[model samples]
Target: MTTSPRRPMMISAGVMAVMAVVSLGGLVFDDRILLGAPIWLKPFKFALSIGIYFLTWGWLSSLLTVRQRLVARVSAVVIGLLGVEYAILITQVIRGRASHFNVSTTFDRLLYLIMGGSIAVIWTGTLVLTVLLFHTPIADTASRLAIRWGALISLIGIGLGGLMLVPTSQQRASAVHQVIGAHSVGVPDGGPVMAVTGWSTTGGDLRIPHFAGMHALQVLPLLAMLLGFLARRFPRLRPDRTRGRLTAIATAAYAGLVALVTWQAERGQPFIHPDGLTLSAFGLLAAATLGAATLVIARGPAGTTVPEPARHTEMAR
Candidate 1:
């Protein structure tokens, strides 16, 4: 079998995917509820998320050329740490206990602390990987920018999880503090929620922005792929610089989206119930993104000359 840098992460991702499927099955048969959602729902979500996360990182790590050994080691550690965190989360879920922010028992608190610590280390490892990515050279401008911006934005998204750790005013004011943090603002955790996602409909939910930001790792790269595909049909999309610029604009717009949602959540506004000001902000962001995209397309090559895509040297397994 041909060993590759992507192998381990891909394996990890597959395991998570299987776990997600199992968790989904549990949802149907377990008939358990926690924090106003099905008990297995959190496990299912985490499993799916971890699967995708590992998958993305697998592809990403395959692209690295510099410091191969170091990157692999760091990635291995991050993946292992995530495994530990997920184990704890699933254990809590199976026990019908809240995985996050639960301080009901000393054992639960210790498990929560371990989860937090593991993720902190994982985040730091990801930072190292990001730095290594910056140092690695890629000939393709569009792909390069996509990878860089995607990684940086993902870090921002992951960092937002920290906000959920802060004790809400309600948690602080209550005489008996069972939970330290909350996912919702302007309302308690267990309340009227949106379908499937369980995001609070009555108040702002931090997970919305956090989810959007973290997935940039895939979104930006997919955008680059989409542009590449479109280039065959449109001569104006032929230029590499044009695609790179477009990716930059998209990254900025996406970052703006993250900021906008974060701001909205902080203001205690539900995502579904955005006020006029929020709408205005969104409109502005949309307009600017559209304008920038238009300008890039207009300035792109009028000729249908497709240049060979830049090739990145893959790291050794």
Candidate 2:
């Protein structure tokens, strides 16, 4: 009844912290393998990711100046849905069954549907919080841009998860299995994979972009923080406007990266095995980002613009 926006989310994050530790232990001690990796691996990764996400939202909730009651209600709903998701995932892991994309039995299908539905609702809840941020004023320009753009991009990232739900051509072709979806493209799920990520090595893996995009919530804000810290040493970065411009550039670049990886994955290309076209596209993106960043730094502070020369010499002309 107190309407404290941060408490529930932070508490949820704390629970995830404990779960992460337990899941890590399970990874080491338990010999059970789900799909291709250790059964506990998915739980461990999800625990860490969800913990960080909730913690970020917990902090952001404090920044909201208006609509305390509404914020609290949304926060509660998001947390509750996350709990549902984790419960099903953990249960499946314990039972030595796949939590995601698994419809091997009636029970499995029901659980998967519940998990998917919960995630959709959770994404919608986060979107409402993000829209609220636009109305809530923050004094710092860099931080404001970081939070807004980060949240928007994070929504895009979260939306990408839905892409995995679509059945691949192979899945459609094979009538022998009940599994409906997969993270990997151009190859089956239980093939050779990367280390702890379990991303397919022989084909495209949507998780690469999904992971990169989702973490923009952390990355963009951290960039703003880093710029703030460096401003103490370098006066060029001392201006709020300059810092804001830099943050905006970084945000665009980060979004571009998410797009690039998503494009690469859709083409059935392994991240480590990029062909010429992918490399060329990435090169262009990097060059543009660096060029824009340099221009921003050269502009100096907010109020002061770079001066034009009074007279043009022959060489200058």
My TM-score estimates for the predictions, one after another, are 0.95, 0.93
In angstroms, the error of model 2 at 195 is 1.3
- Judged by whole-model lDDT over C-alpha atoms, candidate 2 comes out at 0.87
Task: Go through the candidates in order and give the clash count of each.
Answer: 0, 0
Q: Tell me the tens digit of each residue's lDDT in model 2 across 186-277.
A: 88888888998888898999999989989998999888878877776787877777888999999999999999999999998888889999
Candidate 2 residue-pair clash tally? 0
Query: Which candidate number maximizes TM-score?
Result: 1
| Residue runs of model 1 more than 4 Å from their true location after superposition | 1-4, 304-306, 309-317
Candidate 2's C-alpha runs over 4 A off are 301-317
Which pairs of residues collide in model 1? Answer: none
TM-score of 2: 0.93
Over 1-317, each residue of candidate 1 has an lDDT whose tens digit, in order, gives 22455789999999999999899899999998787888888888889889999998898887777888887788889989999999998889778899899998999999999999998999999999899888877665677788888899999999998999999987888898789999999898988888778889999999988898899998988888787777777877777777779989999999999999999998889999999999999999999999999988887778757546432212112
